[model samples]
Target: MEFRYDKEADANYVRLRHEQYAYREEINTERRIDYAADRKPIGVELLCASEGVDLRNLPEQDAISDLLSQHHIKVLAS
Candidate 1:
């Protein structure tokens, strides 16, 4: 997958387009998990090189690590 940063928007987003049914199914599963969670999730766009990239493939911790490494952003462990 590929990642791109949008300087003007001050954000990084991943784009994925699905042309297969399996990919659609995977996305549905992720949506269900997100909905079932007790805490609300903040939606952020991501950039991906693969079509139909699943957000589930993007782990929260990994993203946090990337944020910290790329932008020197810190996350206080709670």
Candidate 2:
């Protein structure tokens, strides 16, 4: 998983490549739970703006924080 901000393009995106499914069942179950909970899960990549809104001038960390804050979403990781 990687987080990057493109200054020229003024876009912020997150890239997560799953090399292998270590716990396929667990992952699937979690996905189901999310759906059942009626939560619209958002990935980092979806945050990118394709309209050429460059956000790269700002600090990457700050930009990410702002996005989550605006969405009222809390990032939780184990």
Candidate 3:
């Protein structure tokens, strides 16, 4: 998995794997899930990430928590 933050976009993208994009599921205004053709989640996009990310109710929370810690990004409780 790869965690990337775009300063210009103020978004954080967690790439779960390198796969073809089948479609995306919007979780809310701040979050979206990218899935492969198999319906397996391949990535997660977090908007307005500067405000901190809420790990609650998100997929792969454990891994994302670790990533956020490594990047020093604030993690908010939803």
Candidate 4:
């Protein structure tokens, strides 16, 4: 998995797999889920990421937390 932040867009993306992109599911104004052709989740995108992200609904919370920490991103507690 990989954690990437786009400063210009204020977006944070968590890539769960390196695979072809199929489509995306918008969870809301601030969140989207990317899926592969098989409908398996391949990535997650958090918009307005500078505002912080909630990890409760995501997988690999611990690893994601570490990655976010490395990038100086905030993880909001639920």
lDDT of 1: 0.35
Clashing pairs in 4: none
Give TM per candidate: 0.29, 0.26, 0.92, 0.83
The pairs that clash in candidate 3 are: none
lDDT, candidates in the order shown: 0.35, 0.35, 0.89, 0.84
- Model 4 lDDT tens row, 1-78: 887888899999999889899999887788788999998888988888889987766656787788888988888952
Task: For candidate 1, write residues 3-75 as lDDT tens digits.
Answer: 4455564444432221221211123422211211333333334333122223344336465445434644333
Error of 1 at 50 (Å): 26
Most accurate candidate by TM-score: 3
How close to the true structure is residue 59 of candidate 4, measured as C-alpha lDDT? 55
Better of 3 and 4 by TM-score: 3
Off by over 4 Å in 3: none
lDDT of 2 by residue, 6-78 (tens): 5565444543343332221113212211111223222233222433232232234355555544544343321
Write the number of the candidate with greater TM-score, choosing between 2 and 3.
Answer: 3
lDDT, candidate 3, 1-78, per-residue tens: 998999999999999989999999998999899999999889999899889988677778889888888998888873
Q: Which stretches of candidate 4 lie over 4 Å from their true place?
A: none
**Clash count (model 1, backbone only):** 5
